[model samples]
Target: MEKLLTIKDVQEHLQLGRNRVYQLIKIDSFPKIKIGNTYRIPKREYLEWIQNNIGKTVFL
Candidate 1:
């Protein structure tokens, strides 16, 4: 089964602040899903994003 991650999970994985995560989503680059007021990200999507941005500086 595919893994689903919460905002906190993404923050922990990326070691970023809550605001930064939101900013990434706002920029439409981060893999995220909005269910009402909550945000969830698929583990695969997060991994893909990491791979896609590899070698680039991710300013958080």
Candidate 2:
């Protein structure tokens, strides 16, 4: 099992606004786990996703 991150964590880590993080989450391939009314991002998968998407433009 890996660490799970909150949306706030992602926002702070990426220096992005809450709206931007939410926009990324709306993307089909973004890694996320929805539990009840909240969302958790798998730490490893999030890192991998960033690496994988480098040099690509993401649009919400």
The TM-scores of all predictions, comma-separated, are 0.81, 0.94
Candidate 1 local lDDT, 1-60, one digit each (tens): 888898788788879899988887785788887889988888998899989999998764
lDDT of each: 0.84, 0.95
Native-to-model Cα distance after best TM-score fit, residue 9 in candidate 1, in Å: 0.7
In candidate 2 the C-alpha lDDT for residue 37 amounts to 90
Worst 10 residues of 1 by lDDT: 24-33
Cα error, residue 55 of model 2, in Å, equals 0.8
The residue-by-residue lDDT of candidate 2 on 1-60, one tens digit each, is: 799999999999989999999999999899999999999999999999999999998877
RMSD of 2: 0.7
